[model samples]
Target: MELTITSQKKTIQANVLQLHLYQQSKVIEAMDKRNNYYYVVFYQDQFINVVKPTHMKRHSHVQRAITNGISLPGDHPLVNKLIGQQTLSMTRFNQLFKKLQQHYPPLETALILSFFDSFTTAGSIPKLIKKTYYDFRRNGKMRKALQALYLLKEVDAQNTFANDLIGKMEFQKYNEAYQTLDIIMEKDPVYFEDICFRHLQDGIYHENLLMFYDQKNRHIDAIMVLLYLLKQQFNETHWQQLQATIQTWNNEAQIIVLSDLYRDQPHPIIEKELTGRLIGSSHHNEVVSFLLEQNYLPTQTEMDKIIDHLNHTDRSQLIQYFHQSKEKFATLRQSITKNQLEKAITPFIKAFLSTYSFEEINQWFRAFHESNELFLIEQTIHTMEKLQDDPDHQDKLGELYASLDQVEQAIDCYKWEMELHPQNTKAIQAVAHLYKEMGNETEAGTYQDLLIQTQKYG
Candidate 1:
């Protein structure tokens, strides 16, 4: 008899196990028990092995053909059918199983089940899954591995052994481990939390996690994780990068988080720096309101730092607020001294000047000069010099210089203004008066003639 072995689209012939059931019929009938009888003999490549009759009960035709000494190919359908029953000896079973595993699709559920069944211990299931997963992964067969993992997960939904393998496969295949994490989280949130904590503790996938959190708009959670990381490891460069990221967010949540961190950590320098950043952000008013509600009074330097970061309109508004608050104004004014007046107090003084009348500003200037604050007087003169085109400002400066006993300088100021505005009777007369004070009668007479000539022309 011949056995037809089909492999894919091809057929071949080989020697298969054959049994003479009639020859053993009398012995099988005469025996008290037929269960222990080995009725068939397999012949392959001049090698022979005995097979049990019960093994082929499911394939009766193949059993009858085997009883007639059939010839079958190595990849015969009967051979595969017999192997699929898992009734062969351990050595032959493993050899045939390995052959099928090597030739068949790795992700085929039947093949996977056959390979899994070959393992004697339940503990080895995870190992088999892991090996199969890596085999597919090594071959760049991500889809196959994912399918295998899904199967393994179905088998053991709480398989902690396969979690890491699945995670790695998902990460490599999808460039994200969250798919695996989500699955794990859904199955066991505590386990997921522990895994995440371990990853964070190991400093693994932190940046990816942060990016994922940001993409999901979980910035507060991301910041909390960053803070935890900083507390655990304290990486200066990483901390700075995190700070820069926080600043880029520049939202109310970030400000609140930073503020809470400051409250908890009590790092005044960091607090001030964070507050300065907040004041510079679009949520500046919100942050300020929060601070005020918390009864947090920023120091003069802190306020100045914030003011320096404001725009022109915001700075004006802030200064107006300061002007209205006597205590706040006093605190601002305490930072101003004669020596540091120009550098430290110029902005404040300018803001004040914008809010007051020119007469009021002049009164302040007179008070500063009378108090022997030479630096303040010099600053006032410098500010007035910027307005030299304004004859009124130039005249004011000239009178100031004359009051300081600077006769030549005052005279030069009037003459400079008269040069700019040749038709100004005030400048011309001032220059003439200064020349008379210096006892230069000829120069005074010259200016008086020029003034009369100007009047005649008019």
Candidate 2:
């Protein structure tokens, strides 16, 4: 005789106990009563232990099933106890009840049950949740816990779990929050609008991300995350709202986001609409910013629009904005693979130098120059050389040449320029004066000869 007990494997069974239980098959055996427990010989030759149907100790099996952390075992009293009790912390309750299994644990159910009990009585779950959040955060469990906690909404539980999630922002915990979101997006697959809303409320959303960039001011990560969000699907309202937000970002921070829409979106009509709405600005500074920050080489039509916009804005304001925007542009420009600056950076440098004095231009380039930002170094030198005729420009021009290891060229540049403008008495006297002061007797004698020669020729 054999026992069919596939699901009953864990009960105190060795091969010998199975043989003894099986040997009694189909016999009218004596019922042994030990304390109030009963045993019977079954047709399959197994000794079955039974408790009275209404007995309290039957709860041990019921509790076993419940504590196993699957669905509640049917009609069990411990179900109420498990669901009702707020006495145990989520972690501890799971440990005590054997819910925290070795592999593929019932973590979700445990967290939900604990959250149910925690939020069951409280009017304000904020502080508890906030504390729970930090605990999960500190333990590196936020990602696992968030997916579990998010399911509580499905249970129609009385808790503000989602709201609490949106409000917490420890700097150390932000990466965890980001990882949690990545998991939710992959696992749950919510609607486009819903994700957008969640992202917006999280304050770590796509368009509004640069506050961190400004705080950390590490523009590369900032722009990378910004681009990553734009690549995601956005519904109509969020798409437009984000467009407007990017438009204003372009205005305020000189960061451009909409051109990425063209890269990812296929519909020409959508592209045209984005072109008209967000990147349509004709202002040279604005257009140059869009081109430089986003690596967008404006099409001829776009270039025309920029030229037109420049007509409307004050030239001085454009110059001022151009100066202000270079720091941000340099931050992005340094990491780029291709030198897109030939058209974009060179024109801005030319425009900036053609109008602003060298002192003002140098002041604008000062931060990036000092930091030795690689992308704009050549452009800065070229712009400085172009602006060299300005009265206060000599020292900076000398500085630029000295930086290039062309110290002799720098000295000669000043001397030749003064020679070309001898009528500006300062230039003439400056050369004779500086050569004599420097004890360059031969150079001083040559300048004196030139002065005498000029008088005789006159």
Candidate 3:
């Protein structure tokens, strides 16, 4: 049978999820603004059914019946018999569960009562949970101290000479614990890492934290830790060791770990490490990406290397680098082939057009034309036109099309130039010449006469 609900009031509201019994269902303890309760099952933005309780009935009993009816997954059919069977009164619903609790649900009233009671005391739950939290934290610290003590014994066993120093460490007055741990860290960084887990989060910063993760292994982290550490501490020896350790992991993990290192601390060494790994992994053109992400300004030598790489074959990488780092890339120009320019996105193309001189721009235009990359040639010309760097762009575009024997496109370019600059002798002559060449003598003669009139009058 279908379910139905009735209310003379236009609006009704209910609280939800405040009790765990109905936390996962739409069942709610609905009420109106006057706190007049509705003993109802609500679903799909509407109340489906309700049974009005007795005049003096406890609101909690009906609310509990509505919420607990569906909370039981295994006893769903039985609970439905008591609570959801059309208009079961509050007195009969409570009697059904109470009288049958022995054979079925087999749960005490205290269990149900406690489940509901906990929500009634929601404000105190966090306090109850945290009452022993400090003791737990103190216990954790004691465990860490014991772990360090055990490791220190291992360190002492490894060297007979430090037994006296280690033994004196028990006395805080002359222990010099920091100095002792620093020596242990310098001797074995992994032990130092375990001794100082989470590093500074554990409230200690070892002089050898970099060495700890370095021993753990990385290319960029090793380098960044070098950057973070005293530059005086890094000689060729440390770098070579770091490099050797990083080279040991596969390229993919190196990419991931170094990518993390780059995100965490983006120094030039990390950049080189990540870029080299990315390139080695056939990640064709991402060398410029970290610079974009980190807004890095590569030094002159780094810029030269990128430009040199472009000349060799990584064109997309080079243009993006120059585009994103325009200030550092100023005063430097790199030759680009038509193939490289064809692969460029519009933003990089725009940037490239702004910085390159006319000669370099024309070279790629001709290259695109040679390779039949006419669209790119047009884009380059259009980008140049927007920048308005060249006063004779219309003539240049006309010349490019005419070179390729695309006389219709060429004539269109010249005619547009004539329309914009009516006295432009080159445009008028080129249009007239092209029209005459196409055997359209009427149009050609009209343009030829206009050209003669302008030249003669001036």
Candidate 4:
């Protein structure tokens, strides 16, 4: 019976760490590598050192293995280095060589797995390896000799055989054999890409193929696969895999991918995460725009985060979001710092004047005045002056001016109201009262007389 890779996982899980100690027992490529070689360790299919991958290139061998497929010959120096160590002449290990020759014309993946199964320690079965090498040479089966030679090496051999199998195995055959997450976890990420490329050849896609790219941390390829999955009929398992993959990334990494996901579809998970990431991220303008475009309103606190970082260019988006949102802005006012409110003042005023009742804007300005935000009140009055210029409604501007103690401006607005409607007693009285308050007795008596005349005419 052939061993299924998933069913016998404990044996697979504890294989040699694949990092080798090199040049004075310092671990290097295919081992617990440190500074000496360019070893890329992965977790959840993503590289452990993503930020400075180029900085890792001290040796070309590992980079080459990762970029270009590995296919080492029997006499390669790396191969020789691998088998140089000694081990017992074990019968079981030698049988691996027989299985390879018997199945040599088309070496099977099951036979390939046996090599890893027999593996015990470094050089654990080199005696069998040497016998196999000599037998293959004697039998003139040099390629099988190389396959025997590969048994001494671990990851590189798995990589080499997997590359060869790509050319020979049908895609589904390879996918059936190796696409399981447990099986994928143990193999080189490059092999997974090869199989994905094969699957793409037919223009047929499965969201589950994300396992090859997403789980393996094949960054560029992962994006293409993720986009495809986004377009397919929604699948919970597919989305869960995508979410789990993103959960591993740093905020910076998450933002770039999430932006792409958001563009392709408006899933709530995508919108929520993209909204969160874009705010404090370098893409703050995006957060503002994203919030505006989204149907679900962000809480006042969430909007304030963007307001705190507001730049001149994003103000328009803020204005767009604020349209008709008085209650939201009112809540934002209590917690917004002075500087943040200042930065967002233009948008806030535009929103208020556009949606606020004529009386409501004056009340809002009074709240600003009480807070000692005189500048904000002035800005609102200025915007209202340009946008809501109704001669009949000078009372609104007069009230704001009076609240600010701009008595002369308040008197001028009330006088304008008196001129626009001579029969209006309230504006004439307001003018007389403000003049008296300003100690201008002449203007006070003049407006008081004008008020009496207007009332007499009415």
Candidate 5:
């Protein structure tokens, strides 16, 4: 029968030492795999040498292997070097060869040669292999052949030696993995879920996460269950229960649990909750709409609190509210800033400029400019566009443009305003004043001509 290990159904209780050792070994192995090729031996507190396969380059054979997926027959120099070394153990030598086979293709000759330099007179084979295994595992390579011996009881399993080996391991590796997994989960929830699903069979996957959600320490089971449901594409009803469960878990100061799960299974629930809260306030619709566009799902109560603060509070209250809930308010505040400026012109035009007359809308624009509201700014600009035909409105537009520091556009608007009221001395003088400021002698002369004509006509 095939062995099936499901974390949910089975208890993954590992002994403290064994769990620590197994984890430490994984760390050392990972390091060896990525960095140095050989396991290092230290003698008298000094680095002795590395133990790795040694083979002289045999190009003709290598080229043949590349082309055919099999090496061509050639004399392996390592085998010849090892034949003279009668001190080499055939048992250990053979074991090394099999281990190399698991990663690289056949290289029996090189394995024997590697042993001539690599092997040291360690007290016990199992203890030595365990030490070497941890070293290699930490370094990031599979010393599976040596590892298999330990598992198969081919090597010694004495606690005194094994425990000594385990204690020597660098805790940094385990700590680093925990930190790394934490970061990966926090930054990307979907990726976390993928990792969990990919390694579902490995009890160690649960073991690693259990650091954050250990029942005896701080139970985050409900949060994990919620995240698992999200990972499994749990429907609305399940998500609702998960929400309740998470709230209960939250009461225990266990945010790490939620954070871990979020890193693995970021879903659309956040935006959904925010939208529910945003509908309560008409002004907040812009904020809600922005969140919706970004596909953000704020938690329900979080959104409700935001809406309540924004709609019913004084300026001091608003500042205090956001200051206290920085995480939730950060995105909302940013969205407000972006939308405020943009919403003003577009929505204002739709609200007033399309149907309202210039004179009638001027008071609204004044209120908008005084308020410095983003929606009102857009509306004032739109209202100005509607009054393009009126001399007073045109002068107001010119003043508005000048106040905004669009000097060139403001000058143009002043000229246009003069054209609308050629008889008005102030309008004609304003054009001449702008032309003079701009150092446009020719344009200034033209404005002089307009002023003369306006004075004569009036």
Candidate 6:
């Protein structure tokens, strides 16, 4: 006869043929012809083979029968006997599972074992769950392994061994892995520390750890890890990656984290990484001060970068720091343009002009003249007169006087140039022109004769 078993939304069709039982009772085993196996043994409407199927193939049929569909009644004696038993002997558990295997599917067997596994804290359940976990993992069944891991966690949430397994599985799922690691850290900090140190050493999940720390509001820890990584690896690419992470933080956090790093007085490579970033930041003045107070001088390029970001007040403060180290004067000189120097005209020009050779200062004055910086021109002329006595200086002064329409002053400067260098043709010719402009034909003719005599004599 064909029997149809329906349970929940699933239906299974099996042909039940009577087979005589070997024992004395009037019993017959109902074999599913389709499966070629006895699903149940019955005597007077009672099931003798109460053991469920263990193999995967027969789970469907066995499940339907067990669910009040066909094979056994809900309150049957065998059913009550199986339900009342809290724990099974290992031999009995194995036997039942084996017999069920001849009739049910693997999944059903796992479910049965898992149910029993939940009730007992000892015996074969733990081993069976572990085997199941590995089996699923070996078959690339990640979800199944995850389910087993969840069960494992239930049994021992603080089990480092179990947490390790869970962490391994969850690592592939970032959020889940983070949660798992968090739990591990809370329950077993030392173990988590070891795990983290190992992964960091192995260069595994370095970025994930950084992000995890940041997400947990552990900015200092994250920066510490980053610095440690950079110290170990010390490559441009990784430094750039580290910098990108630093960029994500607020200015206050950056200051706190980076200040701690700076305090360590790290290797130059790492120090540059720390200070280089700060040099471009709004906190540049503070960083500059920090470096200076530490006697850790920045290179000129680094100082320039810091100064570029400073406001006028902060810039002056930084420049003052530069003044402390005479080596920084070059940087100060670079920053002092004509306009900037013109602002503090007297002292700055005195200081600026004090540093160069006469030739260098003359060249600078010529540049000022070319750019039509008349204030610098007049100031330079006045400063040079007080400071030097040179024919070139006098000739430049005469040219400046003429450019400013100071005719008599031009005559005086040119005559001085002529006296200082008797064969100064340019200055002599300049004096002649100044005299002609003053309508003094006699003085003009005399200098003209002197110029012709000098030129003819040479």
CA lDDT scores, all candidates in order: 0.49, 0.41, 0.45, 0.48, 0.39, 0.50
Compared with the true structure, what per-residue lDDT tens digits does model 3 show for residues 1-458? 11223444333343222111221112334344555654443321222234343342222433444444322222222222223445322233345336435532221222222222222333232232222223433666432332333333432234332344335433343233334667656543334544453342222453355555545443333343343232323344544554565566667656754565456456567667666666455443455465355655444545444443333444345454553443322212233343333333233443454356545545544433433446554565655345443445767777765654457767877877777788889888888898998999999999899889999995
Quick one: best TM-score, which candidate? 4
Per-residue lDDT value at 249 in model 6: 61
lDDT of 3: 0.45
Against the true structure, whose lDDT is highest? 6
Write model 4 residue lDDT over 1-458, tens digit each, in one string: 00101111221111122322211111113211233222222222212220113333322323433333222222222222333332212123355446545644332322232223223334334444546656766888654554444433333344454345334433334345354534543543333333444354233333334454455444433444445556444456656666775676677667766665666577776677677777767666666565445554555567567765554334454556544333444445676666555555545554444354646655655555654656655565665466347786887778776765557777778778767877778888888899899899998999889878768878
Report per-prediction Cα RMSD to one decimal. 30.5, 27.3, 21.5, 19.9, 21.1, 30.4
Which model, 2 or 6, shows the larger TM-score?
A: 6
Candidate 6 TM-score over all chains jointly? 0.27
Which is superior by lDDT, 2 or 5? 2
Residue 84 in model 1: lDDT: 35
Q: Estimate each model's TM-score.
A: 0.27, 0.24, 0.29, 0.32, 0.27, 0.27
Error of 6 at 198 (Å): 8.7
Candidate 2 Cα deviation (angstroms), residue 335: 27
Worst 10 residues of 2 by lDDT: 15-24
Worst 10-residue lDDT window, candidate 5: 19-28
Please give the distance, in angstroms, between residue 284's alpha carbon in candidate 5 and its true position after superposition. Answer: 12
lDDT of 5 at 92: 46
Residue 317 displacement (Å), model 1: 3.2
Error of 2 at 363 (Å): 28
Instruction: Order the candidate numbers by lDDT, best to worst.
Output: 6, 1, 4, 3, 2, 5
